[model samples]
Target: MTTIPSIIEELDQLRPVSDVAGKVLSLLDDSGCGMSDLADIIRHEPALTANLLKLANSAYFGLPGKIGDAKQAIVYLGMTQVVDLILLVSCADTFKGSHSGYGLDRGALWESAICAAILANALSEKKGFKSTGLTFTGALLRDIGKVVIDQHVKSAMPQIMERVETQHISFMAAERQVLGVDHAQVGAMVAKRWHFPPLLQCIIRYYHTPLQADGCFTEASIVHLADAICRKMKISPGVDDSSYEEDERIAHSLGLNETVINGVIGEFSEKMEHVRTLFLAG
Candidate 1:
């Protein structure tokens, strides 16, 4: 049986997010951190620097000229967007492998992560949310616990799905009932291990049940909606996809309705294609 303690021990054996990425996440909570501070940290990692420039100069940004350096990329893309790109590059490798446990073949989870991030950003913009970066980051990593618990879920799928089909419960609930934990809880643990901000940790932990996040309810709600939207688009869905339960009241609280959500879905489809080419096609 895969117990929570064993799962936590396994996290120690798993590859940690890169030091550069850790610094960037830490800087997000630092109000004193400046553009130069971010640029300096990114410059130390050649691959991250290269990826950031490439993403900044991509047609997605529609820049008139090239972004020659990290600082310049920040100037054009803003601190929030630049941080998002760096985190994406830093964390991309972990999602590259096949996760058969979750029925995600090579790169499937990565595509899903990117799709969620983009959708979250777009949704935040529509709602005039000031913390688009936080929402984007939260949505991007919302399913990371799946990566941690994938093998366990795979081995126990029989029991988990039995409950899902017979009990008519959400997959996450089934996961908790059988495995003693769910992906969202495990994902929040991963975020804490990665030294992410407390708000972000709460967002991940309570995204499936945003009202539980207390002060961070709105942010969690945004990520929940984004994840729900991703599933609705049927973008690289895994076995646990269909059982997701969206909170309609939370949607109403965010001032979102079916019409508004459908509009966002249309926008997501267009952007997903463009981003697929720019970020994944390489």
Candidate 2:
């Protein structure tokens, strides 16, 4: 009996991202917003400020000396990267726990999400997409519906898996067949409730099937490809790992081929160690 209303009701009890994080996301569309505005807001959240400074000083960025404050971090990392880190730090706790519904243990989902976000950012840059940050955020939060639907999915795992085995459809399709809604759709609902931008909402909703997004096909496709690449790498995979499908047409449209895909994978593998240690460390 996990109806949409029930799931929507569960959102009220779910831990919310910080107000400061929400404000940063809201400012993304503002032409007047600047680095100082973001730095000021982040400075108020000591935990977020600490995490940002730690990440800035990590070997991943390779700055000359220590970054002492949020403003300096912003100056070094740039606004998009700073905002990406804010959202990542703000949402990390929500994704830290085990989600058995998707066969993800403690920290597994977070690792997978971080991998997807990085790959999506890389792909966006390769494709020369203007919304690299949007793609990064979209890939990171694409599976957020699982947070709300985990228990339901766990209870119905048997039936969902049966459909997956017999029908040879994606896990998302089986989710819809058994539960009347899939994670992507539910994720879109979460984004809407959180007042995320329309483009982001669309990317989360249609990432698995990017062609369905009217105006956001490219952004959604990038996330979709990134998720597929993550699963292919077996990086913290879930029960739905091999059950997901990729659209060759979408890849072709994005000018992605086996060579480009392999290059991204190699690049991701090289950076994986540093990123995991830096982002997941206490």
Task: Compose the digit string of candidate 2's lDDT tens values, residues 1-282.
Answer: 667678778878887778887898888867788988998898888888888898889889899888999999888888999899888988898899999999998999899889999899989888877543489999999999999899999999999999999988989999998888999998998898899988899999999999889878999999999999998999889999898777799989999888988999999899888988988765
Q: What tens-digit string does per-residue lDDT give for candidate 1 at 1-282?
A: 889898888777768778888898888888888888998998888888888888888888998798899988888888999989887887788776778888898899998889888888888988988653488888888888988999999999999999999999999999999889999999988888888899889988988899888778888898999888888888889998998777799989999888988999987777776788987774
Q: Show how many residue pairs clash in every candidate, following the order shown.
A: 0, 0
TM-scores vs. true structure, each candidate:
0.96, 0.96
Kindly report which residue stretches of model 1 are placed more than 4 angstroms away from their true locations once superposed. none
* Top candidate (lDDT): 2
Each model's lDDT comes to 0.86, 0.89
Error of 2 at 52 (Å): 0.8
